[model samples]
Target chain A: MFGTGQFQLYNPVRVIYGKGELKRSAEIFGVSNVLVICDPYVSSNEYFKEVMTGFNSVFIYNKIIPNPPCELIDEIIESVYEHSKGAPKFEGVIGIGGGSTLDTAKAVSSLLVSEGKLADYVEGKKKFEKRLPLMLIPTTSGTGSEVTNVGVYTLNDIKKPMTSPTFWADIALVDPVLTYSMPKRVAATTGLDALTHAIESYWATSTQPYTEGLALRSAKMIFESYEASLNGEEWAKDEMAIAATIAGIAFSQTRTTAAHAISFPITSFYNVEHGLACALTLPTLIHWTYKFISEKMDDFVRYVGFKDVEELAKRIEHMMEYSGFSLKLHDYGVKEDELEKIAKVSVEANIINLTPGNPKYEDVLEILKTIY
Target chain B: MFGTGQFQLYNPVRVIYGKGELKRSAEIFGVSNVLVICDPYVSSNEYFKEVMTGFNSVFIYNKIIPNPPCELIDEIIESVYEHSKGAPKFEGVIGIGGGSTLDTAKAVSSLLVSEGKLADYVEGKKKFEKRLPLMLIPTTSGTGSEVTNVGVYTLNDIKKPMTSPTFWADIALVDPVLTYSMPKRVAATTGLDALTHAIESYWATSTQPYTEGLALRSAKMIFESYEASLNGEEWAKDEMAIAATIAGIAFSQTRTTAAHAISFPITSFYNVEHGLACALTLPTLIHWTYKFISEKMDDFVRYVGFKDVEELAKRIEHMMEYSGFSLKLHDYGVKEDELEKIAKVSVEANIINLTPGNPKYEDVLEILKTIY
Candidate 1:
């Protein structure tokens, strides 16, 4: 039986998706005064020149680190104030990079209207009353942050996410041409990250019929074409781009279940890439989550062209290994004793309860040991 | 290759869906001065009493007939004026029945401010400047009319659909409990109607990845459980309700293609029920459309658990026959010579161009003859 649940969907973000739809950015973003947020790598690239063409005034903030810290956003907030001294007021923000860039853009948009820093609002000390409009052009396919209404930033030395409908972008230009420059290794890990989102969300306790449709299609697209995407098939890049955004829509409604809940501490403590950290635990998590709901597990395997859940997990592991995502816990500078602490931290995360039934601390510890 | 296309999704409708979500209608619609739209059968039901509970001024307009004509809508327009003589102006419209009732409600919402008649807006002579807030509680599983932005009404003696973004409902409270009392004959035809929507929309030339995901899942659900839903299975009723709504969303994005194009004349001329008319020719249309795109056909058959396109078509025919949807054109009072006009009129619909390739008038004629 399809579970009875109330799906509250209110995505007001307009999306313009195609191979070369970025030319319409000026029309979609409206006014000319805008802040362009990205990393130093993206600002140094050639496409940045085209992106800066339409705006009358553009403030560049390129200090975002991976798993972006709140202090970096505080610095950018200072930079925006510095640039606004003798110019027209900033009307919007344009984010054009990976997850951290988009997240920082969203955070900066929210902070401009609210009091204090980003942490104050995130920690419940303040609530934002309004926000600057946002438009995102993603250079990477992994984060799905362009469409989702959350920003993942490092807070108090651990990666924390702030969620509210105010963070959704007004326009997301998902041009596949922007993703061609992503490194092969980045492509693999991010593709796996999207795959994990689709799979974990398919069986989440709160998974509804609408999200199920998206999760199924995402799983089919990523599983069929991710390896080819790693090898740089042009069409596969487009499919992967669309698949990642679709997976984001799937999990954004239900939130991620087990694998995502378990990945935060690994990325924070060991400095593993966010997508890679999520990718590492996904195969084992799939094996574990399938034991709770066998029917859905069977459907997943059948739809993705596998005979059983074990085959599906092994396929994911093979894809990860082929793409250079195979590193032991020790490779990330984790000692043997650190595994238990990591497991405990993952269990304490609020998203852990979003999974089906009660996945005890003991269960997470076992899964960690197996992955290690 | 996944065809390069833009997925412009911006659904701002707040959907509160569950088993008993109709109780929150007062909160969602906001003001108490509301108009109730339904059929005679639905207005006499016990749930109609519950729908009228929290309204200070409520006007009931239950004169909507099947294959709804603009003349009847003109009468509804007059009745609404008749009721507004001494009461506070109706601030909102609450549509609580099948497709005709919901379409009438949406049409009334659009007509509140527009000059002249409904046909003027449909024919591009006038446009709706604003609409009354609409809250829809669907009592049938077919016609994804609740979430869509178009109202199908007969204009100038031909069934015409008025298209606009302004027609989308503010709130769609999809409660499956309201659908359990559907008669078996209604269940069969409407279930087939939804299945056709899913299948036809999947192959539309403008179909995007997101709508394809919704269409595929909807097709799977309706095809799998429609037979059981005809037998009055409780779980099947719930599945059909969700599937039909999902199909509505799928077709709403791209609109329906050739089968829907062909079915309109049958519905308007032969006096066949709207759903049943679409159901009549769907199987043969599936067989014909499959010959054009065999790879997608293979995927559709495999995913829906059929051996081939022919097997899928046969399975559809079997389901229709069991649901009492089998009848010849002659049985509906169409002479053999009328077949040419029916086929010619099907070709004239704007939606026929939405099909994948050039499906000529002769192709439609052959398919109609085979189905006949």
Candidate 2:
């Protein structure tokens, strides 16, 4: 039976999706002067100039680092102040890049209007009440940061995830043309990230019918398009672009479950890419969580055309292998003895509590060691 | 292949769904003084008083009529003004009961803040830019009016459908307990209305992946729960409530297709209920549209667990027979010659153009005669 639990669904971000739709950014943002936060690689892309053509004026900041630090956000804000004489006059803020650029843009937009450092809000010392009109355009398909109300920033050498009402962008422009330039490795990891999001959101203890429907559909598309997307097929990339955003919107409501919670410690400790780190544990977690969600897992398997949960698990492992990544945690430099530490760190995440059957430290350690 | 056409998905209504969520309306609305628009039947329900227990004060207008008219809304505004001595002071507007009550409340809230008669906006003479904080509670599983931006109102003896940004309620409280009291007839018709929404939204030429996923999932639930819901099972009713809202959100983005367009004429000409009127054409149109959307319809059939589109169509016919609704329009007082007039009227609705293969007057007439 579908669970009869109470839940709320609200996503205010207007997602405009299509091929080559980036050209309409000026019309969609409906503003003139704007500040754009993007990755350095994005600024040098051949098609970048055309994307900014309709804007009357723009402030470009392309010094985005992965897992953006709070100080980096502060530095960007200070530079904006120094450039604008402390009276920044921009009608909107646009985030254009991967997760780091988009996450930084979320903080920058809120801090420009509110009084505090990014850390103040990240640390829970303050709340963001409002921000300028904000738009997020993802250059890669993996980080649904463009549509979610969540932002992750590094502070004191630890990743701190925060949610703010203002972080939900006014518009999420998903132009698949932007993702066509991703390297094959980027494609694989990010594709896996989208897949994990689909599965985790589908089975999260907080899952509702609305999110469950989205997750099922998103996962099906990812399974169909992951291989073709890595081969640089525009049609497959287009499907992946839409699928990733749909998955993002799914997790945006349910948050995520053990997969996401576990991925955090693995990424923070091993320097593995976020999506790759998440996928490393996914196959094992699929088996581990089966007893708790057997019928639901069966439904997911059937809807996505897998024979069973085992095949679903093996397909993900196959995707990882095809992408040239070893499935074992030891291959990523994790010592077998360090499994307990990863488990300890994973359980510390608040979201891990949302996992079905509520896997404990020992359970997590067992799953980690199974993969190692 | 999934189409790469452009689309925008934005639903700002916070849908709070649970078995007994109606009691928390006060906390969710976060307002003291409120204007309530409800049906006369609702005010007499045994649980009505409990729903209002947490409110500071409530001004209830319960003389709601089916197919609410423009004069009735103007009268509601006049009564509020007369009661408050020229200035109407309400922190929010709460709409309870069926579609008519909810649709009336949407207009009352917007006209109170923006200005002019409801007709002024319905006739496209003016626009509504804002409304009081609005909350909608569905007492039936059909209509899905609570979550959608579209509202139908009668003006000058014609049903006019209008959409505005302000009509999106701040909250949609879908408490299945509120639907527990629906009569068997209401359950069957409303269930059919929801099923039609799911199917039409899935096959509409304007369909996108986001809505297709929702439509598929919702149709599955409706198929599973419709018969049991008619038997007054609470679990089935709970599923129906969620299914209906999901279908509403699906059509809210895609705006529906031929079945809905055909429905408007049938609903207006005959005194049949809106849901039944919509479903009368559904099975016939399902077969008629199959050639144009064969693969997509196959996908829908497979996902919803039907053998084929023909089997899907037969299931709807079986549902009508079980509900005691006649399969022929002649039984509803439409003369054989009137089929032409109904067809002429059906084609007049612009939404018919959104149908796959774009059925014309002759095509609609054929489908109507087939159903008869």
Angstrom error at residue B62, model 1: 3.0
Query: Best DockQ goes to which candidate?
Result: 2
Q: After superposition, how far is residue B128 of candidate 2 from its true place, in Å?
A: 0.6
Q: Write the per-residue lDDT of candidate 2 for residues A176-255, one digit (tens) a residue.
A: 99898999999888999999999999999988888888998899889988998898888899999999999999999998
Q: Which pairs clash (backbone N, Cα, C closer than 3 Å) in model 1?
A: none
Instruction: Give the whole-model CA lDDT for all candidates, comma-separated.
Output: 0.80, 0.90
Off by over 4 Å in 2: none
Tens-digit lDDT track of model 1 for A89-177:
88988899988899888988878766688888777677776789899888887778888888888888877787877888888788888
Maximum-TM-score candidate = 2
lDDT for each residue of candidate 1 in B53-72, tens digit (9 for 90 to 100): 77787888887787588878
Candidate topping lDDT: 2
- Model 2 alpha-carbon miss at residue B195, Å: 1.0
Error of 1 at B94 (Å): 1.9
lDDT of 1: 0.80
DockQ of 1: 0.55
